[model samples]
Target: MPRFSIVVPVYQVQGYLRACLESVLDQSYGDFELIVVDDCSPDGSPAILDEFAARDERVVPVHLPANGGIGPARNHGVRLARGEYLLFLDSDDSYTPGTLRAIAERIDATGRPDVVLFDYARTHWYGAVKRNRDAEVFGAAGAEVFTVAERPELLDLFTVVWNKAYRLDFFREGGFAFPTGFYEDAVVVYQTLWTARTITLVDRVCVYYRQRRRGNALRTPSREHFEVFAQYERLFRFIEERPELARWRGFLYDHMADHYLFILRQRDRVPPSSRPEFHRRAARDLRAHRPSGHRLGAHIPRTSFTLLSRAPYALYALHRVAAVKRAGLRRRHRVWRRRLRKVLLALHGRLVLRRALDPRLAVYSAFSHRGVLGDPAAIHRKAQEIAPHIRSVWVVGKDHVDALPPGVEHVLPGSRAYRRVTARATYLINNVNWANDLVKREGAVHIHTHQGTPLKSMGADLLKYPGARRGFSVPKMLRRADRWDYSLVANPHSELVWDRAYPCGFVSVRSGSPRNDCLVRPEPGRRESVRQRLGVPDDSTLILYAPTHRDHRQGGYAPTCDLERLVAGLPGDHVLAVRLHPSLARHHERGLGLRDLAERGLVLDVTDEPEVADLLLASDALITDYSSLMFDYAHLDRPVVLHTYDWDTYLAARGTYFDVTERPPGHVTRDEDELARLFASGAWCDEESTRLRSAFRARFGGYDDGRAAERVVRTLMLGEDMAAVPVVPAPGAPSDVLTRS
Candidate 1:
């Protein structure tokens, strides 16, 4: 018998069937059998199945004579399954790579549990992937193996059959089968969970549940959704049959009501004409399932339950309409308020622009008003110290207000104060271009302290790669560049690139990076303090992995390096610090599983750490892929390993300034194996790596002499002449000891 049997019930999923089949067939663990059940599919799924079966003997195609539904099709596959474990997969969904191996390992490690539940991510058609919100439930199980009685919260997970692997003997002994209907899997999922002797969980994401934009049976409006009542009815009957499961009646009732109400509220699911009848059926079911002395859960509003149980459908309909209207009114009021605020701000800004510039006032922003970060923040701090008369005000987004340091004055991006400051401030500083609506006054000084040296094509250079351009307007970009009085360049290469990319009249000041000044002369004990906070040992080899954002995969985080594989392959003392690009950090945290890994002491997720320079100082070496942090990290003179896994793809999709592979700062490895080997063999920080890093540094590491911020402060804010500004120290000079004279 095979170790596992994957049953897939196919209907009209022709678009996704091939990927589903191949996901299973291409698994590293080859002991599983693929049972593709054709539920009278009208599409070309049968032909695809036949094609796969002809090539692979592991495929067992079962064609139904007539359409019985997904439940019956799965039952037929189970009857033929000879594997020790039975797994169900939806034809539209797919298993992630190494899913079966991970499951098999978890099963063995947990002593062959009767049921194994795993996490899944919702893969959208628009290239965005979000992990299940309740994924933490897997880790909250509190043990490797446990029963439902020990952790009933497992029932809180979505009622789905595909995210689990069931021992065939245990399933057959329990006589479990999916009920036929719209929610066929609900009864089966609850039954297996409630009855299983031993249940375990795999915290990793094993499945990519494709959320289709259309053609989804559940999302379609129809009376078939009433099958939910029948499914819950079966679930309650199962509880009735076994009096021992009577304690879970209240919880099950709550689940059924929540599910019913959710379906009723969704605009696309229950039609307006059928809502009254749907509510009537739901009320009847809620009354029928109410256990003796059972009270509704805290999350379920008591008033909602009372209305569903007692109020007439007409009354309930009136209540729902009123609730929706109130919500709509609230939304409209908020929109009106925002519009009025914008109008007022615009008027205030226009009035303020007529007055003389506030020579002592300076406005700072970074990352397009993301927060007070990068060069702008560094410059702001220095101005506060040396040019105390200059009042610094930072413009940040409302969501990122907390990113501001204590006692720092800030205004929201679109506020009246923000507009007034933009209009009146004599010195305006930003790492990125201000909003498109920004107007440059005659006498105002606009300093563009760029975020980093460009490794990829930027500005007008992006005109060649339309994908990289991503709706970039060259005319508007140059207009913003035209506002610049001075452009801060870290090195000669940056000055040349900035001149070509942004054709502006601004003088290119080779003033180095104010941000890297922290790297050159970090506060004493900062490195150790940061390491301690991150739980990294002083003796460990801290490898900071910071990959740049890919222009092709916008709003997505798809790193080519398998983080788990890389971390597992490394020595126990070696800790990996993962710092995601700011753009992808918030959206991809759950998908990356960084929190879980950090808790396990495997890797440090320093993505949210306000200062990137602090992370550089805390790490022993850096691992990057085309991120300009590699250039900044070179200032430390540390070993840098280039993980160029998708170099060719990135180069084609988003044109780079030069081929990094040809002249990398350190050893360049294209695969995780090669990357792991470099660290294991001590080649990551060897003589050749140092030699390459020295050459790369000489080219890109000039101008940052631990006093870039001081120089900028003296020149712009303090009104010091360029010649009078502190001269950059010579190469190999003691940067840490070079204090203000």
Candidate 2:
């Protein structure tokens, strides 16, 4: 008998099957029988499994006669296994290198436990990887073997069969089998955990839990997702049979409540047409399952739980809006309090101040929060480096206080400390405006390091796009813009745009965007270091698809381009890196299908990445649609393809200042077909594209000479005068003169 039986139930995962098999077959610990159960897969997966089985004797292919679900396939694979331990794997996901070896080593060290639960990295298509959510539970469980009673927090670990290995005899003795249907593994995994006399936890990430582009039961929500209730019911019945496990009732109830609440929140998952029926089912399930006289723990919001438990339909229909409004009102109330505090600080400033502004005090806010890593962050770092005597205090939200970097003093947005710092700070730097009521005191300077190269119209232009500016007050915005002591710009076009957009009296600092300084002139090893951190092959033709957000959509800018088709059409040498606009990141769950494509190695989801510059440095080409990233990537002089599938709708909603076709930096592809044709023909970058890039650079890449941050620091932060700084043209910039309006 083999030491381990790795059971991978394959369905329609032909594209990813090879990678999954290779990951298992190439394991460092070779004493394992690979069970590939082809569950009557409609695709070419059966043929692929046969080929793999032929190639390696270890690969045992089980061709199911009918289309049974994953639960049945796994059960069949287990019964056919001849191994001491059993492990389940999904066809779309892969094991990390040496995972089996590591597990074996841990098992041997621990004297063989009944079950071993490990951690995994949730990988997205755009190369971004999220560590397991319940990593802390593993940390708390440690390496030592213990029962569920000893480490009850083990229940918190994600109930996924793929992330663990089970002792075959122990599992069989427990009479645990995967229940057929959605969330089939939930019942068995829970039972196995509680039934095991000795369970061990390993902190290592042994698997790449794929967030697939499509066809995942969890992602494709339906009434079937409600099957989780039945799975839990089976688990509860088993728990009630075991008299010793009675103490777990409250915890189990809380988990059930959380599961139902999760389903209720995913509004799209519950079809609008079937919502009434869905809510009724959810309400009935919660009522039937929830143990009477059980009080929810502090971790579970009492109000939301009570609402969900009693009237799931009403809670689902109305609670979100009411909750949002309540939260918004509370935020506004805090903002008003902060404004009042600033007013009081201003009054005290006039009465007791010897000097109007304190030169040593510099206040910074990046995206109007206490982040030490954006344009304002670059300015702060430069300021401290250039002038050590200057004390910098960052204004952050209450939640970000602990996340603030050491040695940097930070004040909560509305706290007295913030008011005091704002009142005295001579140099005020931010990517966006400060509080509305806080006027810029005389003698103090405000430097607006505008976040990115604006593609969509901003400031005054927002008034034209009603969808973009529903509640915005132009007069109030201009009033805030009126206080700008200086404004930073990447190019002369932006200088003109800012002047027209704000129409303020501030001097347009012909300095490049401080944020792009790292991209334009990266340090010697910065590019390699960042690429290493992102975990992409150095030789791969890195193509970045960084799209902007949409104004008309409530879920922000979702991808219109078919990512799976685009990935399939791309050259074998190429790897696409994806970065969604920040607004889109807020609503990424709506774009989970894109994640499925990521799982197939067709794209890398770098949307969660905080910095776009790192991805830019690693990429050789860019794919986008009306994003300011086009302007940033133009600085790299790389080939960019415009995937403007929703161009007409986008134009009518959030109009751009200039037509992209009129002076596009590279080729434009309206849809996936056009994109595929370009890649197939090897016309991604040509002479015409290069020429357009030169012209585009000449128009927008004037001031980004890698020294914008230094200039901002020397002049604004250190109180120096460098107004005559020359704005040199890029290396291949055209002689065509475009006047700086």
Candidate 3:
């Protein structure tokens, strides 16, 4: 028998069924059998399930005779389970990456508990993930394994069956089966906990319980919500049958009262016409199950419980209205306070702009104030080293300030201090343009450190492709560029491109790329350290698959290459590390199967990683499609493969400066089959690929020499002449090729 039997009850979840199945089938710990029960789904879920079963032998699909509810379908799956432990997952929900491995490790550590409970987060349809607020309940200290009585607070957790794993034998012995109807999980979850001989908590988020915007059975207006009362009745009956479990009577009573109030609050769940009867039934149950000398917790208001039991529906409605109004007033008061604070800050900033410039202050930002990263971060570090007199302050988004390195001072984009520093600072450096509203103060210098080489058409060059110029305004771009005192270019090609594209008055300096310095002169043991952190095996050939964002693609990222096919066809020693463009990172967690591949050790999702330079150092080769990262990777003399599956479409959508297809850095492949063949046949890093890379490097890799940051600091910040700055090393010089074990 397998270690785990994950039972998923499918209904009309055609949209989410595939993601859910992939989440299970792609687990890093593969010792699990997936039991997918199709409850006569009218939609396309059955076909999706059949497709998975045909491909993977581990997937076991069971078709029910008729359309049963979710509860009965789960019971059918459990009856067919043949694994040591039974776990349930809703067809619409999904397991987080490495969830099964984490649970298995926790089980072994806890000496095989009968039931292991783990935390779950709510993933909204609009791309927001929030962990359970009562996650602290799982943090009970002491023995690794214990009874429900040892940590009664676990009862406070959400009554969901999917968050916990039950030993198949223990569950079967207790005859724990979900009841048919709504709120069926409550009784089974509570009974399993109270009956289990041993219980343990994982204290980690194991599941992503998706909160759908529509088509949720419980969220719809229905009288089935009254089924909650029957579910609680079954729980109380089970407790009475086993007198030893009666200690939880008071807790159960309070839980029932809280759940009733919650249902009443959900206006969509309980209809307006049936609420009066629901309220009457709730009051009757409250009186009937009122445990003697049992007081509600301090966190819950006593008045609410009293009102639920004593008052009529009209009185309760009035109280709810008053409470809502008070809450709204408090929210409005907080909003006004925040607005007033912003107004005062703006006034103070305008006043500070009137003062003389601070020669010592330098403000830096990258990727339009997203974070302290890329060329701006490199220049900031270099300035502190050689130009100590200049105090550096990084401008970042408010949400990203915490990610800044320790001791690195930072200011939020719209804060008063950011405005003050931007106005009076002698040096303003950024890889991307600053806010359009920025005032170009005299005596202050603006240095536009271009982030990357222009493989694609940029700035005014994008005027030809209307799709590429979606939100771009050439007039506003030029106005921002007009404030620049200097434009740092990595090579002659970049200088020429910037001259035509930006058409600004700033002097273009061949200062090289500060970010690429790490590629040319990496710190000792840097490659090994980064690879170890990324969980790359010593024998593995790390292929960094960093793809560029497509302007024509709307909604979210659609992989240009068939990642699954490529991974499956490659050699076992070759590992694919995927780094999606920053613009697509937010959508990756939703539908992209990268997380599953990442958990399985076949792929690594390093999109959120701050430093792209570190990823470059960790990889043996790069596979890209029109990304400037290939230009930086060229300095390492590594093989670069261009996967131009959509070459014609991309050129039409977002025109490029040159034909990369004709002058690719290395071997080019238009499909995954050919891409896999190159890696399998060792052609990806062969002599022919290296020769192509050599010529490409000679053209674009001249400026980076491990001292670009130092040169930029000396010339721009320290007021040193270009002649005094370190000269670029001659062609065919010894380049640093990071060796892996």
TM-scores for all candidates: the values are: 0.83, 0.61, 0.78
Worst 10 residues of 2 by lDDT: 732-741
| Model 2, span 686-714: residue lDDT tens | 88889888888777786888878888887
Please provide, for model 1 over 1-741, each residue's C-alpha lDDT reduced to its tens digit, 9 standing for 90 to 100. 899999999999999999999999998789989999999999999999999999999999989999999999999999999999999999999988778887897888889999999888898998778878887787673878889999888888888999999999999999999888899988999899999999998877789999998888888888889899999989899999999899878888998888887887788888779988999999999887888888788888676677877889888777778889989999999999989988876787788889889999999999977877899989999999888999999998888888678888998886677878888999999988988777899999999998788889988888888888776787788888888888887876777788899888887776789999888788899999989998888898899999888788856465557777788878778889998888875553444356545645667878888888889999999999999999999988999999999889899988888899999999999998898788777789999999999999987886888788888888877778766765574355334312121
Per-residue error at 216 for model 2, in Å? Answer: 26
Model 3 error, position 682 (Å): 1.7
The total number of steric clashes, by the backbone 3 Å criterion, in model 2 comes to 14
- What total of clashing residue pairs does each candidate reach? 0, 14, 0
Q: Quick one: ranking by lDDT, best first?
A: 1, 3, 2
lDDT per residue for candidate 3 within 113-214, as digits (tens), equals 999998777888876676677766665567788898888778877888999999999999999999999999888999999988899887677788999998
- Considering TM-score, where higher is better, how would the candidates rank from best to worst? 1, 3, 2
Q: In candidate 3, what residue range of length 10 has the lowest lDDT sum?
A: 732-741
Best by TM-score: 1
